[model samples]
Target: MALAGQPNVGKSTVFNLLTGLSQHVGNWPGKTVERKEGTYSHNGISVDIVDLPGTYSLTANSAEEVIARDHIIKERPDVVVAVIDASSMERNLYLVAELLSLQTPVIVAVNMMDVADQQGLKIEPEVLEAALGVPVVPMTATNNRGIRELVEAVDELTRDEATYEPKRPEIREDHRAVLEELEHLVAAHVPQPYPSDWVSLKLLEGDDEIMRMMEDRLPQETWEQVHEILKEHEDAVLAVASGRYDWVGRMTRAALVRPGVGQITLTERLDRWATHPLWGLLVLAGILGLVFLLTYSLGAPLQGLLETYVIEASARLAASALAGGPSWLTSLIVDGIIGGAGMVVTFIPILIIFFAMMGLLEDVGYMSRAGYVMDRFMHLMGLHGKSFLPLFLGFGCSVPAVMGTRVIDSRAGRLLTTMLVPLVPCTARMVVLAFITPIFFGAAAPLVAWSLVGLNLLVLAVAGVVINRIAFGGERAAFIMELPLYHKPNWQTIGILIWQRSLAFFKRAGTVILVVSVVLWGLSALPTGDIETSFLAGAGRLLAPLGALMGLSWQMMVALLTSFVAKENAIASLGVLYGAGSEAGLAETLPTIMSPAAALSFLVVQMLFIPCVATVVSIFNETKSWRWTLFNVLFLLLVSFGIGILVYQVANVVS
Candidate 1:
């Protein structure tokens, strides 16, 4: 079975509810669009369900649309569940209308029925089912309601097969002959798995994917005839959409009852403040401050406990167990892997808290309001609010932020946004700031942390404007994003998101951080047991002059360099260099070695440093150009060190 829906229609919630931890997530074949597949057992029958990308239509306007359309036509699933918002049936039924024409079994899953009821809208499932000639299951996916009935509906369709005979939409009456004529012209050349009638409709509607395919396959005469017909009825696209809307209108008219004239929804009442032009920005800023505040207040204590009990104890035990072994072996186990990677792992609690808070915001639908409020600011950089969505993802990880640029329709806007995404201070960088800032700044750490984040965004805005003017010639795109209704957040959804993200972090720590730590430790231990006389020391001394400009010693400089491999590696490298196996010891040691002015400069540079290796590779893959990737790295490098030197010099004078 396949799950299909427009964005924010509870499709993901339904998928999660059905699959739980059984799902696998990765990119689509040869595309950055995410693919989710999982198994669900219904009444002793195991069904493999693939969740297609959320798209407004099946037209090939974007990668998501192409992926979803190809999956249904080529890798046909047993059945496709068309999930739609029950409260906004008129808007969502268009996707359903498109799915019905695919000749595949489609079950209309009317999700968010509770939201519909809250708005005083009533929808009759039986009436909708009778009108559309397909199975219709009303559900509230967040509440886990009607899932059994939905599953049973799918089972019935698979067993009987005749229950899915849908009343598909037709072309407008005036253009019916044009569609039939084109169908006859290209029928013989239509590719495999692509229905002749569907191809004809797509050709008439000027669907880019179908037009290109038919253009290549059809004979010259047939192609010319099809093109001529399409040229003559250039308004056929409008006609086709009009037909779908007509079908949706009839079905909705028969099944849906509207509320009173003056009825107001909970979403509207909330949006008054959440989406206000002036107040919305303040709300967004306060919410961000609260998130960071909670991170320190709630997560910091737990992080300290792990460092004191878990990491420190593990390092001590490993040293004791290996004391009788080779001295080098003992140091490698105690100081290299455990001291470095183990220390980095202590910040897992902080990341968990941050991820959970972000998940809660997304689940409750405040993210869109943030984006809506930032739309004007984005316009200043020659982009729209849609670009902000991916940039927001950068706070968690730059890899997804770079990948999320696929949502933007304009290529130039996407590329410009990609350049600025690296500056968003991901959780890895945030963890480093969280750990080190408190050591030097003490109680004012959160204030300084917020300032660093704000500085990065300020740099990002300036960079966006500069890049947009120089490379992209300052083109702007307009967008319309639907704000989902604010509802009680589902803990299960937030829990699953936190689990997935935290698991990813731990996996990276175990692999990348582990390897880098051991390698750096070897460099520091070689030729002598003392790090001061080892290979790593020799290398850091080579760059000591540049470090002096930034008011950082050789050790701090080495940590910044190591961050390119992975942002968390900076902390791991620092632990190994300073030989502090516990956060307590490292925290004490950092303040004594560096003055407040230099420490502030170091934090500024760390926040603006080149993104980790994974994010760099993603940038290259997304842009498909080494030129753009190299430019992004060099641009950030210059900006980071330039600002670092200026900050250090000015603060050194002030202090």
Candidate 2:
């Protein structure tokens, strides 16, 4: 079975519900398109489901459309379930009309019936079934309504026991004559499993891929005749489209009942303010402020408890256990392994809170509005509005942000967005900012933190404008996104999302951070059993002259260097340098070694520094160019240092 729909039609929700925990995601063969497949047991039989890309139509104008069209045509799924939005049936029916032309078994799953009902709209499923001549299952996939009926319809269709033979749309009378004539000419040479009439229609529509294929397959005379017919009826393409809309209009009149005049919906009421240029930004700012306030207020205490009771105690216990062990082994275990892992574990609470809040925003459908609000501003930077999503994801992590560039269709837009993603201060950097802000500024910590975040955004916008002007010179892709209606968030979905994200973070802690921590510890512990004389200190001292320009000491320089491995490691390295037992310990020790000027400058540099190793690897994977990857690294290095120097010098004079 295959699931197909336009954006925001709950196709993904249906896939997740059916597949549960059995789904696997990978790239489609020889394409960058994501392929999702899963298995579910239905009545003692295992059923396979493929979730195709969400495309508005099967026209081969975009990569997603081409992939979806080819898959349904070649793979020949048992049943094609067209998921339609009940509230916007008129627009969604366009895709259904195209699906019907394929002459395959299709079960119309009228999704979001609850949403339609909320808007005072009535849909007659039985009337629709009569009009379309196919099984119609009304459902609210989010609430799991009518899922069983949908599945049973699929099962019956796959078993060849379906009751209805779907009524396919007919072209206009004049276009139908040309299509019939062309069909007769190409019927013998038409490819197997593809209907000759469909081929004829596509040829008339001037589909480049189909025209090329027919030219290669048919004899010269037949090819020329087909071409002549297409040339004569070149305007028949509009007629074909108009015919589909006509059929859709007739079906809708028979089945759909519109709400009374002057009826206002909840989505409409909210959109008045939520999408306003100025008020929307204010609302967005307030929402983000509240989310961060909650995150800090809730996460800080748990973080403290974890560090004090769980991590510190565990470290003391491990050190005692290794009392009789070799000295190097003991240091490696207590300092390298336990210390590194403990730092990562302490961040779980903060990350969980962040993920939960983001998931809630997404599930409730406000995030899409956020993208919409930023679309105009994004155009000024030569990017589509959809590019905001990946940048928004950067607030959580850059690895996924870089990967999220797949959502941008244009190559230049994706590349430009990828280059700017690293400038967004991720949660790891936030951890550093959260830790050091209060230590240096006391009552002004919140303001300082806010400023740093604002600064990151400012830098991102400026960098985007500069990069766009220098490297890219083309019209920005138009942003066309459907804002999903606001709904109450499903707690189960939010829990699953947080769990998956947290699990991925823990895996990274174990693999990348673990190895980097062990190596850094070796560099600090080897050759002299003293950090001052060890190779790590020597390296920092070599860079100390450069660090001095920014008022950063050798220790601060080493901490900054460790951040390239992972931003959280900056805090862990500070704890090691100061011999602090916990984050609090390091906080108390920071003020003694640096002034407000140097501390602020250090924070600035960390905010603008190169992305972590994981993110760098993701950049390489997405861009497939070491040249761009190295450019991002070198570019950030220069920007960070230049900003650091300016901040440090200005602060010195003011002080």
Candidate 3:
């Protein structure tokens, strides 16, 4: 069985409810699109389920569409569950129309019935199932309603005794003959597992993937003959779409009852301010400020407790346990491994709060409004408005930000957005700022932190404008997105999201942070267990001249270098370099060694520096070109240092 739906139709929520923690997530083979697979078992029946990418249609215009259609055709899941928004059934049915034409068994899952009810819309699932000649199950996935029924529906369809014959859509009267003629011509040549009639429709629709596949497989004369029909009837694609909409119209008229005129919905009342040109910006700002305030107020204290009790106590216990071991072994376990990675591990509390807040906003359907509000400003940078959604994801993490670019249909727009995402000051960078800003600026920490975030976005905007002109010739793509109706957020869904993201962070601490810390400690302990006379000291001094221009000491320079491993490692590396017994010890030591001017410059550079290794790898994977990847790294390096020097020199003049 497979789950498929348009974007924001509660498909993923349903998947989460069914699979829970028993899901495997990874990329599609040789593609950046994510794939999620899980097993469902109930009543002595077991089934494998796949969650396909959210796409508006099955046309081969985007990688997502190709992946979705190919999976249904090639892999051929036993049951294809089509999840649709009950409130927007007319628009959602277009994909179902395409799916029915594929000769597969489809179960229509009418999700978000609660949202439909709130809007005063009523849909009869029985009428819909009868009209479409398929099973229809009404559901509110977020509320955990109708899930068992949906599962039961799936079970019934998969049984050997079960049978279904769906009413599929067809081309217009004038083009039906042409479709049949094409189908006849390719009847024998149509590849295995691909229905000849469906291939014929795609050929008339000028589907690029199908055209190329047929062009290679068909004889020259047959190809030219097929091409002539397509050339003569160029509007056949429109005819096919009109037919699908005609089918959808019939289904809607039979089952959907619209609200009375002048009836205002909750989404409508809220969008008046949420999507406003001016007020929306204020609302977005206030919301962001609230998120940060929550992070500092709630996450910070929890982080401190973890640091004080868990990390510090663990270090002491480890040191005591290894007391009789070799001196080098003791230092390696306690300082190298625990000291470095443990500091980053303490960031879990802060990351959880931040992730939970983001998940809540997204689940409640505000993210689309946020994107709509930013569309105008995004256009100024030659970006499609939809690019804001993925760029916004950068606030949580860059990996998803990069992956989220798949939502953008335009190639140039997606690439440009990917490049800009690294500058978004993700939670890791925010965590570093949260830790350092208070120690440096005291009561003005919040103000300084806000200013640094503003600075990163400002630089990102300037870079986008310049790069758009030089590389992309300032070509802008039009934005089109469907804003999901606002609904009550589900805490279970939000908790699961936080758990997944927080688990990823913990995995990083165990792998990347652990390796870097151990290696740095080894470098600091070699030839003698004294950090001052060890390998790291010689390396830090090598960059002394460059450090002088930015008021950064050699230790600060080394910390910045280690940050490329992981942004959180900057603090951990400092602890290792300073030999701070605890986070408080490092905080107290940092101010005495560096002046306020130097501290400010270091923070500036840290915020603007090249992203960590994982983000770099994601960029390379997405772009598939070492040239662009190297360009991004070098561009950020120059910008970070140039601004760092300017800030340091100007601060000195003012002080």
Candidate 4:
């Protein structure tokens, strides 16, 4: 089952009600529109449902709608429950009609009945059923009304195959000729029992998917005749587009009853304040202040707690193992891997807490406001208004935000955002803050962490200006966003989301991380334990010239290399190299590298360095090319190291 409807209709609520699932639902697949799946039981049978993105029609215009329509047309779900907003039948019915034409037995779940009634509009389910010739159930999914009726309808449609008479779009006389020709050819061959007129209309419209289906089956002469009809009009595709909307408008006027005045849209009032220049600016600042406070106040303690566990356990295990086991194996498992990997994994809960809160805000529709409020700032950075989401979320984790670029429209903006988002310090960088920032600056650790983040964001802003001047060479992409109405988030929904995200991290630790930890254990233990001559040590020695500038020794250089595998590995590499650098222990060795200025420069280098292997792998997958992956890796490495060198030289000269 897939919940298909127009954007901002009650589709998400219906999915929440039907599947008893709360996940981030958006308009694009893999971007804002990552495909979400959940399962529920009806009549003792578990049925799996996929929530396809909200698309306006089955025309396959945008990437999101195309993904949705392709899945339905190909996967052929057991049953599709089309959640239609009763209040906006005209726009909503366009999608419903397209689905009906697929011959996919669909039960129309007329959602937002509460809104319809409040607006003094009546939608009779029987009338809707009679009109569409399929089951129509009106319900408020949010309040759990008519849910039983919807489930029963889905059950019947999936089990019993009853062919319903679906109305095909009527065409004008000019297009009627093209339809007749298309109808004559597809009538006998196609298996799906969709109406002939619908198939004809699709062919006349030059709907590529359906026409390709016909071309593969139809005789050459038949298509030649169809092609002749298409070529005859100056812009034949427009004919079909106009005809369908015209037909949809006629059906909507007949089926839906609405007042001369629309009901008071709740979002309007909120929008006025949320988008107001002065009030909106303050609101955005408050949200940012709170988010910053959480990162430091709430997350710092948890990071400290997790770090304590890592340090104490590593010390005790190392002591006990040395008494009974081989020194090398014990050192590898206890000091090299556990001490290293554990340091990183300890921060997993804190990262999860941050992600969960961010996810909840996004689900309840508050996150978009961040983009809304940050439009002016984005403009100054030479980006469109909506670029803020990717930039902001990049601070949490660049992987999702990089993927989030699908929501951005322009090639230039997307590329610019993709390149610069990585500069924003991620949750992995949080380990650096909790571990080193305090050691370097004490009470000012949080402030330093935030300032570095702010500085990186500033760097990104300057880079954006350079990019626009060099690569984009045009105005920022057109920026418009649909701000959904605010509502109370369902926590049970948020908890499931947190479980999925955090458990994913834990699973990594148990499987991929565990294996890597073992491999890292072997790498760090073998050849030699000498800080200057081990394999990593040799590798670090090559970076000595670069390291001297940032005030980091080759040992620190090795830790920087380890950061690529995992941020925690950097800390672990250090425990083997440096002491109780406990969870609360300041990154005690950083100050020894050089002056405080060098320490700050060292932090900046770490902040902007290349992402982990997982992020690199994701980039490869997103680009579908290894060359691009290598390019990103080398570019960031050069950029990060270059900044470090520059900072060191400048600081030394000033001193």
lDDT string, candidate 4, 1-655, tens digits: 8778888877877777777753444344355557777888988999888888788888857777778777776688877888888887777887876787675677788889899888778777876677677788999888889888988888887777756566655555576676677677678765464455666667766777777877787778877776777677536567666666776776666667775535556666676777887788788778767776786678777777766776666668676857777777777667655665565566665667667777787888877877777788888877876788777666666666676666677766777777777777887776675667777688888898878877777777887787678777747556567888898898988888888766754554435445666666666666775544567777778988878867787777887888877765676666656653543332454465447777777777888788865566556655666876776678678878888788777877887
Report lDDT (CA) for all predictions: 0.87, 0.87, 0.87, 0.72
Model 1, span 107-132: residue lDDT tens: 99999999999889999999999999
- TM-score, prediction 1: 0.60
Candidate 4, residue 184: how far the Cα is off, in Å: 22
For residues 475-523, what per-residue lDDT tens digits would candidate 2 score against the true structure? 7666568989999999999999999978875775447667776887888
Q: Worst lDDT window (10 residues) for model 3?
A: 504-513
- Any runs in candidate 4 off by more than 4 Å, and if so which? 1-118, 121-229, 232-263, 275-285, 368-391, 397-421, 434-449, 462-483, 568-593, 621-624
Candidate 3 global lDDT: 0.87
For each candidate in turn, the TM-score is: 0.60, 0.65, 0.62, 0.61
Which pairs clash in the backbone of model 2? none
Q: What's the best-to-worst order under TM-score?
A: 2, 3, 4, 1
The candidate with the higher lDDT, 2 or 4, is 2
> C-alpha displacement of 24 in model 4, angstroms?
47
